[model samples]
Target: MEKITNFSVRIVQKYLPSAFVLAVILTAIIFVLGITIADQGPMTMAGYWGDGFSKLFKFGMQMVLVLLTGYVLAMTPIIKNALNALAKQANTPKQALAITIVVSFICYYLNWGFGMVAGAILARAMGSSVKVHFPLLVAAAYGGELVRGPSSSIPLIIATPGHFMEDAIGIVPVSQTLYSSWNIALTIGLLVLLVAFFLLQKQPKDIIVLEEKEEIIETKVFEGKMCFSDWIEHSRIPTLFLGLLAASYIINKIISDTFSLNLNTMILIFLALGLLLHKNSASYLNAAELAVKAARGIIVQFPLYAGIAGMMTNAGLVTIFSNAIISVATIKTFPLLTFLCAGIVNFFIPSGGGQWAIQGPIMMEAAYNLGADPALTIMAFTWGDGWTNQIQPFWALPLLSVAGLSARDIMGYLVIWLGISGIAIAGTFIILM
Candidate 1:
């Protein structure tokens, strides 16, 4: 096991390009695929690529905030202290990996943004205190995303009213999808597989722990008499007021029973909690400054991915791909095949909402014709979208940034879990759904 893992890590580290380079490479490859498969002209692909940049611009910024807000929330003094306490629990490498996976999976099961940032930061905390293979540890942090299939995002999309496909399939409520027996079973089943599989991977001898940095609290010390401006800088009143404003709306959301724990609401919650926990403007802004550093990777790389999505959709590649895969599906095979199709498409279009916009309609329509259950189909598509994320670099940006590792540093370990999860998710859909 150790030899195989070492070989995989060595090969990926030697050959895998940086995430940005991989995005550009994916762009070029997609451009060519557009020409060959979709028979799109170069100008057409370029047009799609350019236009598609705007498609994900808003979503990209949302991701940036996801990293920023999540980071800011994680950096608060209370959270930092909590992480330090948690870090002390793991004395061995195996224990470190196990705890990281459990923590990450739970966070991911709650909100992708929280899971993505907190998991990575926690891994860093663990690496600092425990003698573990840092890459494998980070990979375990990321592996928690496996639970997103049922907890949020893709499933939430189809369940919401006014979704792109709602007019056709009607609104598939959360009770039918997220809260279903099959989905609950699959989620639990996959998590067990993820934990066991992650723990089994061999740890490396050459461990890379995080470099110690200065304390996060940054106060402007004025030895002389303090001025009014300096007084405001240290004031907690601003944060108190800000927290109250955000908290009021959240209160209304829960009071009305409208809070779905969706990504948007989760971000708001993070913002409110971050502000309240920081207690003062100085600590809040200090955390914000460092949060930007962690968010930089997400800011630059997402547009490239958006353009890739544009190319795939514009060139009709997503359509072509989805149709080809689902065309041959039977009732039992439809769910599994749709999952298979989604996993393949996710490499090019990593965004769950983006893929669902194009492929969701196709698969949902195909499900109706084949007599496959709509909710089951949704779960299958969700699994496929997340399944390939094991090796996909786009979604890993935020986690990798906070963990201070490159994509190659972790992808090798994830590649193995990708297969394990593939079989588990695929088998669940086939046997049960």
Candidate 2:
């Protein structure tokens, strides 16, 4: 297995392009496919791409906030000290990998945005001292992002009352989708499998460890006579009041049971905590500027992926692709088939919500025709969106940036996880769903 992993790593390092290159290649492929296979005119395809390019702007902003807030929160003095303290617990490489995976599992299961950066920070903390396989530790941390957990986008959207698909599928409650027995079992099972797969990877005699740890610096005092403007800039009043204000809103929502873990809500949760942690505007903004850099690729690439989704939608490529596989599914096999369709489409449109936007209608209609459970189909789609992330570099960029690693450095290992977990997911859909 170690030999296999090393061989896979060598292959990926040799041939795999960066995430940006992958996006451009996907865009060109989608364009050509739109014209040839989808039977759309080139001009029509271009217009579809243009019109649909910005459709994801709202979701894109939410994603950026997730990265931004997560980063800023981690940079706070209290958070940094806590992470450093926690780093002391994992004294060995194996312990570091295991503990990072467990921490990531809990964080990611609770909130994806929080999990995205939390794992990297924890891994970095552990790597600062432990002679661990740094890339492997980071990969283990990132591997826990099932994307189908509490912060899942598609499930929450479909469960919402005013969603676009409501007329067709009705407002399916979270109990039927996210909180269902099968989904719970599937999530737990996948996490266990990831832990097993990642931990079992053979460690090297000379493991990659961080040569230099990122120093957490104290915010220094102003050198000159502090002016009124300087006082305002560093004032803790705004952070206290505004952070508390955001906290109050979240508290009310939680108490009232009205809070759903959608993108905006997740951002607020992170923001409230981040502002409180950073203590003042200057500190928060400085950390924010650092966080914003992690999200730069997300800002650039989301539009390209959105354009791909637009072309797929307008050119009827979504229907074409979905119906092609869905055509063969029997009533008993519908859930498994939907999972497969979602996994395939996940390659082009990496976001679960975005994938659903294009492929949901087709699958939902087929579910009705085949008499399959809509909730099961939804969860299946969610897991499919998640399963491919093992090899998908889109979500890994921020985590990689934080860990100071590249996609090629870890994808070889992730590719192996992709195959292992995919089978487990497919089996669950087949046997249980």
Task: Please report, as a residue range, the 10-residue window in candidate 1 with the lowest summed lDDT.
Answer: 208-217
Each candidate structure's TM-score, on Cα atoms with residue i matched to residue i, is 0.94, 0.95
| Candidate 2 structure quality by residue, lDDT tens digits, 1-433 | 7888888988998999999999889889999999999888889999999998999998788778877887788788887777678788988787888888888888788777678778888898899868888888888998888647667888889877689999898988889888889778878888788888887888877688865746343476878788888888788988988999999999999999987767778779889998887778988888887677778779889999999999989998888889888889988888888887888889899988888888888899999998899899998888888878778788888888878889998888888788888888899888974
Model 2: how far residue 23 lies from native, Å: 0.4
Model 1 stretches with alpha carbons more than 4 Å out: 149-151
In model 2, which regions exceed 4 Å deviation?
Answer: 213-220
Worst 10 residues of 2 by lDDT: 211-220
Instruction: State residue 338's C-alpha deviation in candidate 2, in Å.
Output: 1.1
List model 1 lDDT by residue over 1-433, tens digit each.
5566667778998999987888899999999999999989999999999999888776667666766777788778787788778889999988888888888888778767678878987888898888787888999999878676333577777766677787888877888877888778878887788778877776555667666554356777789888898888788899888888999999998999887655566677888999899868988898888777767766787788889989998789888888888778899889889889999888878888777877788888899988899888988888888888888887787788777778998988888778888898888887875
RMSD of 1: 1.9
